[model samples]
Target: MSEHNEGDLFRQFVGDVKPLKQTVRGDKRPAAKDTPGLIERRRAAQELGNKEGNYLARQEHISPVKPWDLLSFKRDGVQHGVFRSLKQGKYVIDATIDLHGRTVQQARQEVFHFLRECVERDIRCATITHGKGQHRDPPALLKSCVNHWLQQMDEVLAFHSARPQQGGSGSTNVLLRKSQAQKDKNSEKFNRKTSRK
Candidate 1:
């Protein structure tokens, strides 16, 4: 009974007191600066990007496959009928570029840039009119350059001389490989069709 009474007295004594405030911290370390190695690495990456950007902005060297001659190539393992279809002008031409009288340098840049855009837009078939170099003493300078450049790019699946209505041998019809996105979309459709069946 005495112990219970003492306990009640102690609780009453402690109940009215306020709690103490917490101590706020005053000192904090500042954020870390980049180390010397990190800074050097960042600078090197930036310089490389600038160099590549400059290379793209200016002339890209084009090695002619063969000067002033019919030029053609296809990456190996392409299905046999694909090239033949292009040669037959079976694919509808989705885009066209005329390179008449442009310098080889200008034509090279334009052709690459245009083809890049075409692939992005999912264009598969295009016609490039390089002109037969008819009036030139040598003949077919742009034609040859265009041919060589097209062969060099992996995007070009096949090309052949267009018919009389399409500028004949002077202008080549090009078949570009389908973009990966386009191919994936087609595969998805195929899968869906098979799944339904």
Candidate 2:
């Protein structure tokens, strides 16, 4: 067949199909430029996040505890009665945080933030539910970390293993130190009573 006839046959087969426009494969629009304040704002945000996470230290050398072991701690000035009460789960738990599935780092950050918020809100009693890690190679790793972490916190007056119905050895009851406002209120009440005498 002649080349002209072949061209005619190709046009007939193609019909009215339009040719594609030659263009760049990707987006042609220029990248958006960040404002001067935007960069600074992002940096400040990142620094703030780091600062928040910095409240709790990621200790390298941690003492491991058994899965079934009971956790106990008390600050030097914490009364024996208060510690005992905490152990017995007599104080009402104002807040509770469960760290069952969280990583060590995640748990550390969460614990720090949660306790800080609790103290700010004048919460006296809080419970931390760190599951006894019987499945892990080093059993109760998070529990041991929680035990160590609680001791290092000044806000924690005392803590003990929770009662059986409250998660048994898998959870801990924490006694937080009274906020300054609460202490001041107590002092004011005492003074008022004494003055009335």
Candidate 3:
């Protein structure tokens, strides 16, 4: 082909290959001015303050009685009825009391001693794994005895059948009276830790 003809053909090819440019026009609404409702809402929210508007605000307005704020022993008195179901943690004792192994008198002393120790240790909650007395033919001697013993103990705030995860009906969950030192230490620890954190 001739140079002039080839140059014209190349120009035509370049023109055809080039893509068309596009411009986008946006149909946007104008920025909204502050309406009366919006202004009022802002004013009301600000006027309400944190304390007036929120549920937690009311809680803050009224002095809260923290778990550690009240006297442990005094608070325990009020919680005497509800504590059994409320507390679920474990306080295990290495020593086990077997009713079958001991005489009636010995068993009574053992029960008293165990309860006293629990109170002294400031153990709010503990489990007495009194075996279900499966071997006892007619009735569960240990189970019945533990129930009776717990009922008699003044220091036993409350007692109930333990959760299935925690020995189930075989064990009794016992809530005991808090000792002075335990109560004080717990309150001090809670105050120090909770306030700072």
Candidate 4:
């Protein structure tokens, strides 16, 4: 082949390759800014979380209880017999919340919400299973927290560690105050008299 013909063939092969104008780091489009509606929605959600978190004390410190210890409480005016029933796990548990794998913050929020909902639904008896917490540094961390927090809630009329069959020291039996509707229903039941002719 003549030198000119060979050069023409090389040019034809190389013609498509061009020098890069700039090195591309990546997709360089401007960062997307959050929309105003999305920002407002996030803010509202955060506020709701804060409000709910306030219901239970998250940082308050109390002396830790032993993992094997039993937890019990009874507000004034709660009859001894009723408290005994609760201690004996005699009342049918209407609901239960298990905090076995939850962090302290999670357990706090769950306990507060659970008790509130139970009261609203007229749940007279409930169980809270806060694992022994034996592996934690403070020991019985969740159990101790549950013990203190339940004392603060007015809705909790009484509480006691569960029986062996229930959950032993790892769980608690709670007696909640009656809702207004429940109170009215009970009153009606007691006040109504049957008339037979």
Best by TM-score: 2
List RMSD in Å for every model shown: 21.9, 15.1, 30.0, 15.1
Task: Assess candidate 2 and give its lDDT.
Answer: 0.85
In candidate 1 the C-alpha lDDT for residue 97 amounts to 85
In candidate 2, position 77 carries an lDDT of 84
- Per-residue lDDT tens digits for candidate 1, residues 1-197, read 69999999998999898899999886965646768995675456446545544233222343433333454566787677987787777879999987765666666666776677689899998999887776674456677667667777778888888766787777788888889899999999999999999
C-alpha TM-score for every candidate: 0.63, 0.72, 0.45, 0.70
Look at candidate 1 and tell me the lDDT of residue 60: 38
Q: Candidate 4 local accuracy as lDDT?
A: 0.85
Each model's number of backbone clashes?
Answer: 1, 0, 0, 0
What is the TM-score (0 to 1) of candidate 4?
Answer: 0.70
Over 1-197, each residue of candidate 3 has an lDDT whose tens digit, in order, gives 99999999999889768676897867965656768995675455444444342222111122222211111112335454465343443445333333444433444455565666667876676667655656554345556556656655667676666666766656667767778898898999999999998
Q: How much is 39 displaced in model 2, in angstroms? A: 23
Which residue pairs overlap in candidate 4's backbone? none
- lDDT per residue (tens digit) for residues 1-197 in model 4: 99999999999999899987997788656755768995675456446557875466564675578999999899999999999989888999999988876678767767777788899998999999997988888789999899988988989999999999999999999999999999999887777753321
Which ranges of candidate 4 are over 4 A from the true structure?
1-49, 191-197
